[model samples]
Target: VVDLEAIADQSYQFVEWTGDNGTIADTTANATTITMNGSYTIRAEFDITTYTLDISSTAVGNVIEPGEGSFEYDDGTMVNLEAVADEGYHFVEWTGDNGTIGDLTANETTVEMLNDYTITAEFEINTYSLTVDSTAGGNVIEPGEGTFEYDDGTMVNLEAAADEGYHFVEWTGDNGTIGDVTANETTVEMLNDYTITAEFEINTYTLDISSTEGGSVVAPGEGSFEYEHGTTVDLEAVADTGYHFVEWTGDNGTIGDVTANETTVEIFEDYTITAEIEEMAAEYYQLTVEVEGNGTVDIDPDQNEYEEGTEVTLTAIPDADWNFGEWTGDHKGEDAEINVTMDEDKNITAVFEEEPTDEYELTIAIEGNGTTEPGEGTHTYENGTAVTVEATPADGWQFSEWTGDVPEGQENETEITITMDMDKVVTANFEEEDTTLFDVGITNYDEEVVKGENVTIEYTVHNPTDKVVTEDIILIIDGERVVVQEDVTLEPGQEVTLEYQWEAEDAGEFTISTDDEDDPDPVTVTVEEEDDGMDMMLIGGIVAVIVIILALIGYMMMKGGEGSETEMEEETEEMEELETDEEEETDEEELDEEDETMEEGSDEEEMEEETEEEEMVDEDIEEEL
Candidate 1:
C-alpha cells in the first residue's frame, strides 16, 4: 500500500519502490512484496528543475569563406551546442533544435544559447531576485555594468531573490533603460520599456514528483529519481544499461526491493473502497494497467471430480519430449493402472484379457444302398443330423477339456437317433468298432394266385446258402415293423405260408414295401368276401315234387264222389227202349242197341221153345210131302 501524501487527496494513489531495470522491482515505495497472483500499480514523474550545464567542447577560428566552421554573437562564427548532464540521475538527453548547452531542472526548464559559445549557467533553489534597475538591497543581484543602452533581463526567481517588503512583479530599469531577462526562457528580447531593480525571496518545492529510475550508483536493474530540494518518488521505465531506484522524502513510507519487472500484489481478489460523505453523484477511481513481460502460458486449477471405482482410458499428448511419470489422481479398479507407464507420447491405447469357456454331441447312421445291400452301420459320438464332432477319448486316454465347440458335455457312448428323411449317399464314421450288429433279411416273397383273388408279388432273398438255415427276420409294414418272424426251414424251391393275422382292420390298397424296406422276401396279401347264390338252386327242386303228388291224389277222389256206375245201368235200359221202338227192317241202330242188350241178358234158348212147337205141327205136314 503506497500512501503518498501528495496523492492522498487525488483519485489515483501511486505505489513506489526500485529495482534493477530488467531484473524486477516493487512498483510503489509503500508496497512491500509481489503477491503470488494477479495486477499491480505504478506512478511516474520527470523533474526538469536544478539540472547541470556542462561544456566539454571544441572551438575553431571564424573565417569568411563559403564552407567554414561555426561561431556565435555574429562575430562571424557558426558553432555546435554540445553539452552533457552533470546533476547526477536519469536525465532526458537534449539536442540542438531546442535549448542547448545545459541541464533543465524546473517544471519547464529552459537553457538558451549566448555569446559565441562562451556563456552557460544553471538554476537551483536560491533567492527570488526580480531586478530591472541595477541596485542591490540584500542577496538581490544589482547590475555592475554602466552605460547600458538596452539591457535584456526582465524577471528573476521571485522566491530566490525576494527582499524584506517586496514581491517583485517586473524588471524595471532607469527611465529609458530596457530590461528583458527571465530565468527559464530560451531567447531574450530587445529592452523596450522595462526596468531592472533587484528583489529577492525564498521558498521550497513547487510541485511533487518521484525519481524511480535514478542513476545514483543504481545496479543495472534498479529504479530511482533525483531532485534539488525536497523529493517525490516517480515511476521510471526500466532501462537495460543502468539500475533503477526511487527517491522519496517527507512521509510517504512503505517501499521495498522485489523481483519481477512487473509484479502483481493480490491476496485472492481484495479491493479497498473509501468514500467521503458529501456526495451528489458517485465517482470512480482507476489506474493505467501494464502487462510487462513474456512467456505465454498460464495454468491454475482446483480439485478433480470423478468416480473412485470405475475403469477409464486416459490419453496424453504433449508438444515436448516427456518421460513416464507418476499418476496424480485416482485410478479405481483398473487392471494395469498405476503399475503401467507410457515411455513416449503418441496416440496410445490399451486392452483387457478374458477367460476360457467348455461344449459335447452323438449320432446313429446307416451307409450304402439302405435296401438289399446295406454296407456298414455305426453308432458314433461325432456323427449327427447336423454332424457335430466330439473329442471322444478312448479307454486309456485322458480327456482334455475343449475350448471351442464340442459334441456334448464330455459324455461318452451316448445314444443318438438318426433317420433317413430322404434318399441320401451317407457314410457312418466312428472312433471304434461296435460290438453288436443288426440282422435284416434280404429275402422277398413271391405268391401266385388267380387274378380275382390273388395278385403276383415278386420277392428276393440274400445272405443264404444251399442248406437248412435259421436267422431272425424283420418284416416291416409301410414304414414300421409289422412282424419280426424268426427260425424257419425251407428246401430251396419249396415254400410255406408266412401266416400273419390281419391286425390292420381296413384293407388298404398298399405299397407293400419301399425299395429299401427290406433285404429279404417282401410279402403282400389281399383278402376278399365269400360267394352267395348256389344254395338257392337245391331248395327249388324239392318244392316242385310236393306239388305233383297232391295233384294226382285229388283226381281219383273226384271220380268216386260223382257216382259214375249208376249212370252206366241207366244207359242200358235206354238202349232196350230204343230197340222196341224201331221197325224190323229199317231200324238197324235200334236192333244194334237190342243185340247189345240181349247179349248182356238171357234170351236165345227160351225163344227157341216156341219155334219147336210150331215146327212139330209143320213136321206132320212135311211128312205128308
Candidate 2:
C-alpha cells in the first residue's frame, strides 16, 4: 500500500491529485491510499483562494456596474463601483469596511478588495427650491427676493418692507407653507418647491380742507392732512363773529353730514373740502299780536318791533272761568306759552274759551262677545252732549241691541246715540249666531308647553246631519278670535281635521277652543319658562367647588391629626428615654453601694486573721518556756 497526501500553503487551496499509473482508492480526496500493483506517479494540485465581494446600495439607488449580490474575486483585485440615484436623489458617500474606495463622494468610483468586503453606496434626498416675489408696493427684504435652495423641513425667515404711503398686508403662498399668513415678518417651511408672494396696499390719502373768509376750520385743522384709506376724519368749522356757517362742500370722498358745521368725511381718494360761510345781515321786523276770545296776550320786552333772528316770548292769560286753548297764525301750537322767531313780519293769535260749568259722565258697558267704541269705561262730556257708540262683535257673534239709556228707536241699532243729560250708563249687546254646522271636538293638543315655542291644536269637525254644510272654523284664545279657517265645506257624515298653531310668547295659562258651539270643552295649556342649562351648570360648578373645598379641609384635618399623633409619639419616646436614663442612674448607685459593703467585709476578715496569728504566737512562746 502506498499513502498519498496533498499539502497547501497559506492563501492557497488543494485540488485533487492527478496520476495515470496507479490504482488510487480516492483520487479526489486530499489524503488517500493507493494499491501498488505497478509503478505509479501522482501529483498534488493547488490554487490561489478568492474572496467574496458584496456590493449594495441604499434605498432609491442601486449599483449599476459589477451589480449587486456576492461576487468572487482574487485578492488585490480592483472592482469598479457605480451608483445611480433615482430622481430627486443624489449620491452621498460610500460606506462599509475591508475595502479601499477611490472616492467616497463620487457616484462612479472604484473599490480594491483585500479580503471579504461589503461596500454600500449611500444616497440622500435632494434639496428643494424656494422663490419669493412681491407686489408693487412692497419688496421682500430677507433672503432678498430671489430663488433660494433649502433642504426638506427647513424653516426660512421671511420679511417684507413696504414703501412710503403703503402698508404690508400679508404673505400668500401654497396652503400651510407659511407659518403666519397675516404677519409681514414670518417664516415658511420648505416642504416642497414653493413660490410665495408678499402683498401690500397703498392706503394713504391726502385731504385738503379750507374755508371761506368768514370761518376757519378747527378740526383736523385747515391745512393738508394725510389719512389712511377708509379713515373717517372729523371736520369742524367755526364762523367768526357776525358770520354764519352754511354748508360743507367736498370734491371727493363721502361727507357724513354735509349741511352741518361739524361733520365727518370718509377718505377713499384724495379730497378737497370747503366750508362756506356767509356774513349775517341785521334787519328788523314788526311783531303784531292779536287776542281772540277772553285771553290777554303779553310779549316779552313789550316791543312791537324786533331785530331779525330774535326770539320773542309770548304769554297768553285767560280771564276767570276761561282757559288758553292754542296759538294760531304764523306760529300754530297748543302751548299756553311759546317762543316765536322774528325773521319777518310775525302775527300770532292767542285763542281761549270759557270752561264748561255743567259736565256729565257717560259710562259704556259691553255684553256678550263684543267690544264697544270708547271701551267699557266712564268718559266725561259736556252737559246735553250726544255720544255715538258702535259695537263690533267677535267671530260667531252679532251685535243684537243697544240697551240702558239709549234712545228708544236706536235701541235695536248696532250704532246708537246716547244723550248725556246726566250720569248715564249704556250697554252694547251681542248675541251668538247659529253658525255651528259641524260637531267639533279637540283631538290632539299639548297641555303643557314651553315659552317661545309653538303649540299645535288639532280638532276634528264632522257634519252629523245629512246635508252639505259650509262654515268657518275659528280658533279662539281667551275669548278672542286668533285664527279662522274660512269656508270649510264638508259633505254629510264627513269629518276633517283642522290644525291651528299658536306661538307661546309668554309663560302663562291659556285656553284654546273653536268657535263652533258644539265644542264645549276647551283645552287649557300652561306655558312654562324654558329651562336654563347654564343655571344648572352654574349650580353644579358651585357644588363641585364647595365639595373640593370641603375635601381640602378634610385632608388638612387629617394631616393635622397625623401631626398630632407624631407629636404624641415623640413625647412618648422622650418619656421612655427619660425612664431609661433614670434606670441607668439607679443601677450605678446600687453598684457603688455593693463595692463599699465588700470593702467593709474584707477589713473584718483581715482583723480576725491577725487575732488568730497572735494567739498562735503566744502558744509557741509558752511551749518554748
Over 77-189, each residue of candidate 1 has an lDDT whose tens digit, in order, gives: 23343333332212233333434433433222344433323233222222222223333433333333222333233432221244543333434343233223333112223
User: Once model 2 is optimally superposed onto the true structure by TM-score, how far is the C-alpha of residue 563 displaced, in angstroms?
Assistant: 99
Q: If scored against the real structure, what TM-score would every candidate get?
A: 0.17, 0.37
How many clashes show up per model?
96, 0
The models' CA-based lDDT, in order, is: 0.31, 0.79
What TM-score quantifies how close candidate 1 is to the native fold? 0.17
lDDT value, candidate 1, whole model: 0.31
Q: Could you give the C-alpha RMSD of every candidate to the true structure, in order shown? A: 58.4, 42.0
Best by TM-score: 2
lDDT of 2: 0.79
Per-residue CA lDDT of model 2 for 536-616, tens digit only, reads: 433443354345335444644565655566655654464455445434444543453334224445435544543454344
